[model samples]
Target chain A: MHKNIESQLLKLIPPQSKVLDLGSGNGEFLEKLSKKNISCHGIEIDTKKIIISLAKGVSVTQKDIDKGLKEFCGLGFDFVVMANSIQCLRRPLEALNNIFEIANECAVTIPNFGYWKIRLKLLNGKMPVSSSLPAKWYETKNIHLCTIKDFEDLCADNNITIKKRVYLDADLNPLKSWFTLNSNFFASEAIYHLEKK
Target chain B: MKIQQNSFEYKESFHLLNGGSIPGFELVYETYGELNPNKNNAVLVCHAFSGSHRAAGVDKETDKPGWWNEFIGPNKAIDTNKYFVVSPNNLGSCYGSTGPATLNPATKKPFGKDFPLLDVYDWVASQNLLRKSLDIQSWEMVLGGSLGGMQALEWSISFPENIKKAGIIAATSLISSQNIALNQVARDIIRKDINFEDGDYLIANKKPRDGLRVARMLGHITYLSESNFKNRFGRKLQDINNKIDSSINFEVENYLRYQGEKFSEYFDANSYILLTKIMDSFNPAGRYNDNLVDALRHCKAKLLILSFDDDWLFPTEYSKELHFAAIMAGINSSFIELSGNNGHDSFLYANEEYVSAISNFLNHA
Candidate 1:
């Protein structure tokens, strides 16, 4: 799943482009991106992750993503990547706007809370737990969990253009099923390549 | 671990950053482990204001562990077995180094007030001389907390290529005005002592005991948080038995006075005055017209900054400032705000999380 996330991001980020990572945990992915000649700087607040990120010699600012990216406004980064972190924020709407303000091109990966399997679990009177949302209801870090449709509605409401959208299954594998048209109910998660309209 | 102090005397005249010069000086330092053949594994630990060369190991004479014994040992945070550790006493400090208490060759009297006032840059320069004397090409890491942290930051900036990494803990790039004011009160308390004699108490054959004692007591308040103080000695009285006589003393007062008395017994009055003044004026950004990014632009060394959330003396925001400058200057840096009640003194403690943070950052290849 981690490798799949990397490959998906690698496909969008070209060589020699500057990247800003919203929640660059441990700087592992940024370090990988740096190997491809991509300049990467990150903003992370977790103490353990920041320590590891620094030990790896990656440039990361210790900051809360919920605070937004006002300081980075107009920095003209080629890409601002938010991976599996949008659901954990208190102000997802403001964060989306903040991401669009920093760069014209950005990538956001989120767990689809509205997947069909999740609906079935809820219908069966149980809290949904998939690989994408592995934590128990009480243990979950997500405060703004949203479905793919909800996210798309948010983007549409804020004039964010969806350049390309890739749907992934429970194991984060990109699903190429015939019914991808109804992805809001089938996919467990998503990789979104968005642009500022 | 058993350790011995070593002395290095630079015969040439040592110049101060303040356009003053001393006719040669000596620096006493302690070393642990062995310097590698490549000469790149030396970790230099700069001492805080009242700190000494004894950063780790047991002093054979005193049978006491060094200040950072909890962090630097065979398999500790610095890992002495893998890296050579060197801790040096600054020039103006009174820990077996050339200081105000040391005899001057000019008139065969203690330098005292005549001792050229030194700054953080001077300490860094003197440390560099020691580094050259040891024949180390560049340091593996230079680290410290408080005043020591200032020295580490200075080393990274002044001798940028000479240091590979710097760990600055509980320090600020610039001393805030409130801090200067507090330090001023401490310095004035010492200076106004009847025996101070214009910082020449040594020549007068008198020690400013009362002045130094009161000053340290006042200075100690800023080093801890209110919650930590409460934890240690809140409203508890030291003497519950003296109720009839009403000679009651609070546990906090007793603790402060005890610490102050112990400090005054050893620390030189002039040295205290000079060192606190150095802490007063440490603004690297001042040279760059108050632009922190431009001040940090020339730094090639990677930085690890650790700040305590409860440290009001140098708050977490100050550490964040350095992180911001490091990022904007295109340097690799990381900042960690550890949660603890020890306040400014939190960096000196061996908190498990703090230890791991230091260990992982320093030992990373």
Candidate 2:
């Protein structure tokens, strides 16, 4: 599933573009990007993850996204990515707004909380847990999970134009008619490319 | 292949009198290669905290190469063939220069903790004396990294008429709170140790080995990026014959331990304390002067500040801040963030791109 998402991301970004990966866990994506000559930078709050990222030679700043992106002004980067980390943010929208202001393009990937499995589990009075989100509610960093449709609507409300959208099933296979039916059932994750209006 | 040692006495040993006097010391310096009649081919190379007047080529005592042999040589960046190079052992340093470790004739003992807090400006004042002693009016370039970069910045600002170009690498305008706090913690560790004996351990034949080791360990963490640590050490375990206690402890622990242990052999604990404190008090911003731009406005040199992408100790943002200040000051300054996985030590590592960028910059300068 991670491999599929990575391949799709690689297709979207140009080779050698400067990229900043927010909440860049272990810098896996930046390492992949660097092989393609992309100048990669990252920010992660976790000290352990930061150590791992630095070991890979990825230029990462240890910072909290809640503080806004002020360090990167005038030093331009082509893309800012928040992968599987949007839900973990205290103020996800505000962070996204700052990302858009600093980057020429922004990409984000989030788990669809309204998937049928989660819905059925909630209906049975049980908190949802799946391969995509394996943590218990107390242990989870996914505080602000949202559905694909809800995310698109939020983007629209924020005046952030969707440049591209890709949907994946539970196994990360491309989902057909993902923009419509997948918000509630078939799709497990949604990847969106956004540009500031 | 013989290197000569040069010496001179300061007009008055501020190391003796009012300990806080600036522009108080006279500098005695040695030069390699010939100085041009106009003296425009001169290159000033500032030393690190513990480094000495010998920067390039070989040292006579240990039959070892100079500290920065990789960067300065016949065909190197600051080519001795084309440029007359001058390296001064900074004031408050131990290398044949006037420092806290030096003997005070009046006190008949080492200055110990009584050494005045030396800043980048103090180092520049000594360099000015050295320049006058050599009969050289100005320098074509002033270059350094780490503590040396601080001196280079001072040369640009304090003696703007002397330097034509300045190259500052892997340095910060102001030491961050984290660094200051870290140094304070290390100092506390040393001070609390019974062996330290209030910095009078010399009489007792005791040294703060444990305290200095802990300080170096803390400092070593900041010197390398997390990325470098993981790549070099990761979760690798130390080799052991006994299987009962076998555990895959991270390799970084052993590496840092080696660094700390080895550092003690070559460095003095009290000097380490003093140097770190100097680094902490290094605020180019000046007292009651919050305006960095105004502070840097006096610089006339074409400045270049380089930061490694992975160097968390003195992160790229610090370099960016300096670059911004230089711009507002109308100084011709360029900031380049080089790609490297080695963190802060990348400047010292065998990085081809890093070397190329610097080589190009110096050639153009």
User: Against the true structure, whose DockQ is highest?
Assistant: 1
lDDT of 2 by residue, A1-197 (tens): 29999988878887667787888887789888877877776777764564455445444555678887766654567788888998998999998888877786888998998788888889999889899989999999889999888898899998999999888888886786744454557678988888895
lDDT (Cα, tens digit) per residue for candidate 1, span B130-222:
999999989989999999988888888789989989999999899889999999999999999999998888888899998999999988999
Flag clash pairs in model 2: A54-B227, A54-B228, A55-B226, A55-B227, A55-B228
Report the Cα lDDT for candidate 2: 0.74
C-alpha TM-score for every candidate = 0.95, 0.62
Question: Which regions of candidate 2 deviate over 4 angstroms?
Answer: A1-197, B1-4, B13-19, B22-31, B60-64, B240-251
Worst 10 residues of 2 chain A by lDDT: A50-59
Judging by lDDT against the true structure, name the best candidate. 1
TM-score of chain B of each: 0.96, 0.88
Q: Residue B88 of candidate 1: its Cα lDDT?
A: 91
Model 2 chain B: worst 10 consecutive residues (lDDT sum)? B15-24
Question: For each candidate, what is the lDDT?
Answer: 0.87, 0.74
| Residue-level lDDT tens digits of model 2 in B129-175 | 77877788888888887778887887888899988878788888897
